[model samples]
Target: MPHKRAKRSIRDAETAKKGHNLAPQASTYDDTPRSASRIFNAHAVQSAFRKAGRITSEDTGERKPKPSSSTNTSSSSSSSKLKPQNGSSSSTTPTTKQTDPKKPAIPSILPNESLGEYNRRVEEFLRPGVSKAIKEAASIKAAEEAAFRREKKDRKKRTRIERLVKLGKMPQAALDELDKEMKNKAGKRKRGDEDEGSGSDDNDDDGDKTTTKPREREEKSFKPIEAPRRLNDIVQAPPSLPHLRKLGQEKKVGKGVYGAVGKGSGKDPLNAGQRRILEEERERVVKMYRDMKAAREEAKVEEKGAKVKVKV
Candidate 1:
């Protein structure tokens, strides 16, 4: 009986201790609130509030109620101020002006204005010199023409004189007279010769007979003699005295005879000094010849002496 009582007391003490631990735990849990919303789905709750009109969507087109008339008046006043600033800048900065399309940009200068002025200035600068040169040239040409004409006249006169001299047709005095007469009669003689045809009948008959003669006889009769032969023959003949006088102002030899000497000689001619030198040289040559002859004779004598000695 004592053992059963001890066991029942132990079981009762264990049941009380268990009740004490459960009561505190049940009170702490019961005292805390059940949160009612999730922490992670906060955006979904906020979107639901927005759709319900509790939150406003400013950027999106979920139309909010329109603003009052006072707000619109303030915005219009700001825009009008900005428009005046742009208009003032456009008015102050000017546009570039257009140029004329038809006209060329470079200007033209006239030839008559520039070139004419240059030509006039050049002419003024050179006029005096050019005129002086022209005058000098004219004077020189006139002098040349006058000289040419004088030379021609002198040559003609000389030829006429020489022809007359060769023909033995004129003395000095007669030559001057004949020249004047010929000058006067020249036109008349030319006309007469043209009209004469063959010449007078008697002259023609004589000419025919002359032509029929041997050509050699005709040539011999008319041909000029060589100067040397003429001088030698004429110098010896006495008939040349009158002819020598007609040579006038010419140096004469042996009274009215022209001695041929120097340039005038028919054979060898000499000036006074040349003639003297020649005579001296000739004398020296003759002396040399005599000396040579004497030397040859001496040599011949020496040879004969050598031959006699050899014989001995």
Candidate 2:
């Protein structure tokens, strides 16, 4: 409760004459205490923490006590405040509710039991459950972490494969094999789910008819798949150097080959399709050069024939 100051009273109320001048000054402020400071017990502290979810009841080994005589008095005062005259309920006595038999009653603190003994008893009552919960939580977290790492690795590998494919490094056969593996895995998962469903149904029926024996479960073997060889490995290409020129610098033509344009690492080879396209482009360039040479020779021959005609 907050401390409230006493209200000031009129200084000369009794001696005041009609129309007499009243004292302009009021009384000084009073500093008297209103309510005593609250005292906290360990049990009350534990109960507060429990209610606030900061600690479990088993951790403190204390149970909340039922409302005492003080609460009853407070209830009576509240009932008086909400009287029938104030349009409240007319019942004078509070009703007693029946306890459910299915619900377990809280273990009461023994009169002779110390706090330490109560804590020990609580620990004894809760140890098994707490340990089991801890183990399950730890195992679940470990499995989740392992799964996350595996997924991260797989994602990195997939991205690497995609990057190589874009750079014309991976072979067509490798891509085909990867697609086939994915399809087979999907099919296997669907079949496995169906099999498990049927097996569970059969087990349930057999259990109903007779006692079922515990079956030893076989561990599934996990084999790591080997990554396919890069196309460059099959068709060796000349080692290309990286571009060493800085930005904004003019590229010198007819000087030296700077680097291969749009090509990734020199070690990574081009796919068969790219190689074929390069071969076709080379053949076309050669054919165009030969035609130009033949045309230049014919022009020279026509100039000579005109010179001979003029001489005759």
lDDT of each: 0.64, 0.67
- Can you tell me which runs of candidate 1 are displaced by over 4 Å? 1-113, 171-312
- TM-score to true structure, per model: 0.20, 0.29
Q: On a 0 to 100 scale, what is the lDDT of residue 109 in model 2? A: 53
| Candidate 1 per-residue C-alpha lDDT over 257-289 given as tens digits, one digit per residue, 9 for 90 to 100 | 345444444546557899999999999999999
- lDDT digits (tens) for residues 52-109 of candidate 2: 8785546655443333354677675664432222222322323322266754333445
Report clash pairs, candidate 2: 232-269
Candidate 2 residues lying further than 4 Å off, grouped into runs, are 1-106, 176-312
| For model 2, the run of ten residues with the poorest summed lDDT | 82-91
Task: Please give the TM-score that candidate 2 achieves against the real structure.
Answer: 0.29
Which ten residues in a row are the worst by lDDT in model 1?
102-111
Judge candidate 2 against the unseen true structure and give its global Cα lDDT, from 0 to 1.
Answer: 0.67
